[model samples]
Target: MASRGVGAALAIAAAGLLAASALGKGWISAGSASVGLMGGEVCRGGKCKTLELPEKDGWRTTGTVAFAAALGAAGLGLVAGIMGLARKRSKVPAVLTLVAALAALGGGIAFILVAPGKGVMEHLAWGAYCGVGGGVFAVVGAILLMRAAGAGPSYAVGMPGTANPAARTLMLAETAKVSGPEAKTMAPGMAMAPQVQAPRPSKGAPAMVPPCPKCHGPLQFAGQFNAWYCPRCQSYLQV
Candidate 1:
């Protein structure tokens, strides 16, 4: 993704430079005539006779400014790409690359607007190229940002079904719930019969007890503990 962004920035910058060059050529053709007060040539007789150029709206100024802006954006993208390569954990570089690409696109648009009428098609073509390049940078930068923020791809480590530290803790808790002693206590009645029984008959008394120590419910002691046990409270007491 970072590579894509860098590529886009470079493309946009190149297109802007190309458009600016064409505009500069037109400006040069228009300004090659008579010397003005500033010692620069002025447009005369449909041509500029003197080599000196006007300060503003001159072919040289237009081309130089446009190319400079494009190159600056390209430089920024290059720097961002280098930083991204160096700093694996940082998203700053990726963001800078996207910004650079956008700048290049903007410069291209400006060049298209300032270029001569006959060169409109060429300017539009350059603008489109820059737009596409900037779009690529933006997308790549976004992906990089997502990845840096831990929102892309899973690198979880821990239990087979879990992710990070918290997930591991929860997994262990759930496993304990399923396989611990509480699970055994809730098993089928067949496994609990011997453990839960009625008491033996007291001398000259009823064989079954009616009062439980824990809850005053009927008591039983089938045989395991040899003591009175409550079926309701599951408590046991020595006979």
Candidate 2:
């Protein structure tokens, strides 16, 4: 639960950062021509021109890709957060959250690499800082969520549709072992031990005890006591 809460916060933060990065100016250009994320404007002899990102400029492609990636990360983070809330023990959501974080991180790196460095100088904007911060937060949240997934109860505990009948049978077999030991007797100064075969469910017969309705833990049938027992809840179940 705690991990889920943290994950939610981080995901929200990531979304905020990604939004800012997408809307704000992530790069700036100077010299004969000035180009920034918002737009590009022409300049001459250090005179400033209108701000716009022109389609003809090749560098704009890199910025566009990075922005797209950031947007994708933000969207994925929201999805992961929702999954984390609904399925705390599920690892799939955590993996997705990690992927989202990596996307933002990768995008930021790409933007840095492709940023203008020649006649058109580039400056890191607020969007870059926010994006980096958001990516870090996302990574931390994903790690926490993954750790929680491992510590939670089995996912199949309450979902009987996915439960394995063979596993339940094995569990019952192990439980039967603790009922009582084999009977032994000594006769004429000699000790004799009789072999006993564990009882098995008759072919096509229904199970002795079904899974607990609440916890889904294996149930034990106590023939001698004439009652079905749930080891998980330590309560006798109605026949």
Candidate 3:
């Protein structure tokens, strides 16, 4: 999913860069002159040029640079998304997404700074749109990658130690320990008595036991109210 999203984003970015480059080239080819007409009067030529306007001599080079940067960032994002989906065990893709997002932002800023006066606002608008969109895609991809690696919201409860199977088994064993006349008689002179095992279910009985909600672990059968309990985590649940 992340891979597909990144690929789509890359395609959009590539198209945007191509359009911007084409527009910039067209502006240069049309003779770097400004023309304005107000009522019957006409204003034209170098008198309309402003200091804030990008220099004509190097504008194409700058546009090319901006386009290249945007392409590079989008390429990186695509690679990161592919890695994230394929590996499913590494955080490298998440880090790569963040880097790609920053690169896209930088490229957008540079493009805005070097754009010509006539379409400067339009250029900046497109750049801002691409920057923001790329950034959002990167963040969402990073989050999905983290989730795929099992390092995010799913395990936010705690680490693996307490949820270990062996640990849970031990806890269950402890909880199953018994201490009555029948337990002592079963072991005779033993210092500690063995647990009183619950009767095995009949052939037609349910095979899977329910789990406790709090710890999401298997629960032990408790007869009276058709309930189950997680001895390890001390959680109760309806059977």
Candidate 4:
């Protein structure tokens, strides 16, 4: 239930992590030689040489992207956290933070997972962990904030998305229906007719009898001729 507090706390933590990751150095380190977002040094026999890469886009470029993305995520997460702590329902902050986090995650993957380096510390780098971790934290925090921002109520009866039983049962008392000549009262949210209907026959009902057209008298059944006989009318009657 304490969604606001929880969401705010998570966002703050994510912001802190991302901020540090974006600014910190030592993305990769082996002994005294260490690498960062821009460049690092290579040492041999107590001597060190500056690493030089192609002028075009390279791993450093990806690292730079990652650094920028991390910073963006941090800023967004901090804002989202502040909004959540204020007990305000705002989806913009959460959504933007999630987007920035995803970008940061993509950058981390590009440099930490895809790009290759000469040394053994290429994949096992502290800066890489920080970037990835911050992204993950931001993503989770954004999700919590989104949840904290309440959505509207679900539908009532006959709705697939309806989740509240109470809503489904609302207005269930008064309903009216009419089928054929008979009027049938029904409860709201209930079917007018049952799944199956039982057959009924009238009791003591005389069939195959008709009144004479002219005399208006009941015609007698004629079993032998398969018709009716009107004694008063004295004519063959069809029943």
Candidate 5:
């Protein structure tokens, strides 16, 4: 599961993509001359040229490339967020987040380096700054998510015992029980036998009688005489 901090960071980074897209358009001022850059209308001497993504130049323009990268990063962020929240966690989310951050970062850099304006004094617009900021935040969030994924349940190290002390103890105890004296003391020739107890009589059941004294045969009880007698012996039994 993605930590709350990491999730929040990814969300913020995704927002950066929007910011970057919006900020990548603006004018650069040079003395008295102002020129529009990437994704904006360039004005020089009252003449204007509009540039947009997938420009008429067949997507080869610097503006298109930079914006594309930013878009890619934003898409990756969404995917990473979904994967991070999956029931079964995996490294995919972390990888996706990292790729997203890198894409955004690269896009921002490209936007500055490949900006479509020629001016003696060029000033970047707020949108460019937002893109850069969002990229930075995304990178930070990705790193955190990766660390969290790898750490797993053992995130907290150097604690009193261990991260999952109860589980460890249960495992150890089970191992000990299996390897202890009762398991090891069995003889080669003799097998371990389960203990069998005599059946107990019910509360209202008659009591049992001893076998015959002479023949050790089954005995019969006489209710009227209030005495027990042996059938095979057929003799008066002593009280």
Candidate 6:
């Protein structure tokens, strides 16, 4: 539960940061000109060129691509966060969150690597930092969400799908020991006594043992009480 809460919070934060990065200015060019996922301006002294979505400039094109990708990441991250907050174990949320991080990081880096040429002075700004931070948060949140999900049942070798090797044992190990009489004076060449097999746990015991309902720990069958026992909880379970 705690993991889910923290993960959801991080994912939501990532969504906000990533959205801001996409919409707000993140790069500076030509001294006074700035651009972001949306667009930028190219300025020379007192004159400034406003770049927008339909512009054919190389840098603006890159920003357009990044803008779309960043926006998608933000949307996906928001959905994933909401799903996690609701405590839903759906795998799609984690998967989508990870994909969001990848898309955001890729778009941001692409903008930086292929931003400008022809003597254009361009440097990263707060928007770029926000994208990076959001990507990191998305990754961490996805990991936490995956960790919080429950694991599927396991099967043992040569056993049915419902049968788990750990549950097959009915009771604790209770092998008989040979020590009552002449063990202290036994000859060195004597054969060892045969070990005694422990008794069956229950007459109609099921082959499968389930995970504990409380802690999800492995359970053992106790024949004397005809019930499943959780060693971790140190108590008998009704199932």
Winner on TM-score (3 vs 5): 5
TM-scores of the models, in the order given = 0.36, 0.52, 0.42, 0.57, 0.49, 0.57
- RMSDs, each prediction? 18.2, 11.5, 12.3, 18.8, 19.0, 12.7
| Ten residues in sequence with the least summed lDDT for candidate 5 | 190-199
Q: Give one digit per residue, the lDDT tens place, for model 1 in 1-239.
A: 45434433443443344343323333212223222111334455676544543344453354345455445545554555444445344565455545654554555455444444464453233334444454355435534543543422333332354445466665556445434656434323422323433344554244656576456777664332234556786655444
* Cα lDDT computed for each candidate against the true fold: 0.45, 0.60, 0.45, 0.65, 0.52, 0.65
lDDT of 2 at 67: 74
lDDT (Cα, tens digit) per residue for candidate 5, span 16-134: 55445534554344333322224555556978766443343332355455566566666666555555555224656657766766766775565466544454224765565566766
Q: Write the per-residue lDDT of candidate 2 for residues 1-239, one digit (tens) a residue.
A: 57668976787677778767766654443435433344556667767557655445355676666677677777777766667677656777667767867876876666666654553324555566787887887788777777666652563243232245456554444334433252132113322212222234443233664666666787676443223556766654433
Give the Cα-based TM-score of candidate 6 against the true structure.
Answer: 0.57
Instruction: After superposing candidate 2 on the true structure, give the runs of residues whose Cα lies further than 4 Å from its correct spot.
Output: 26-58, 87-89, 118-122, 154-239
* Least accurate 10 contiguous residues by lDDT in model 1: 28-37
Q: What does the lDDT read for residue 159 in candidate 5?
A: 31
Instruction: Return whichever of 4 and 5 wins on TM-score.
Output: 4
Position 175, candidate 5: lDDT: 38
What TM value does model 1 have?
A: 0.36
- Model 6 lDDT tens row, 1-239: 57778988888898898899888875544467777777767778889787663344465577777777777777877888888888677768778778768877877777776665554333667888888888889888877876665422221222323233344331211101112243333234433222222233445476666776667788787543334567887765432
Model 4 worst lDDT window (10 residues): 171-180
> Which of candidates 2 and 3 is the stronger one according to TM-score?
2
lDDT of 5: 0.52
What would the per-residue lDDT of candidate 3 be over residues 130-169, giving only the tens digit for each residue?
4446555555665555555553332222322344445555
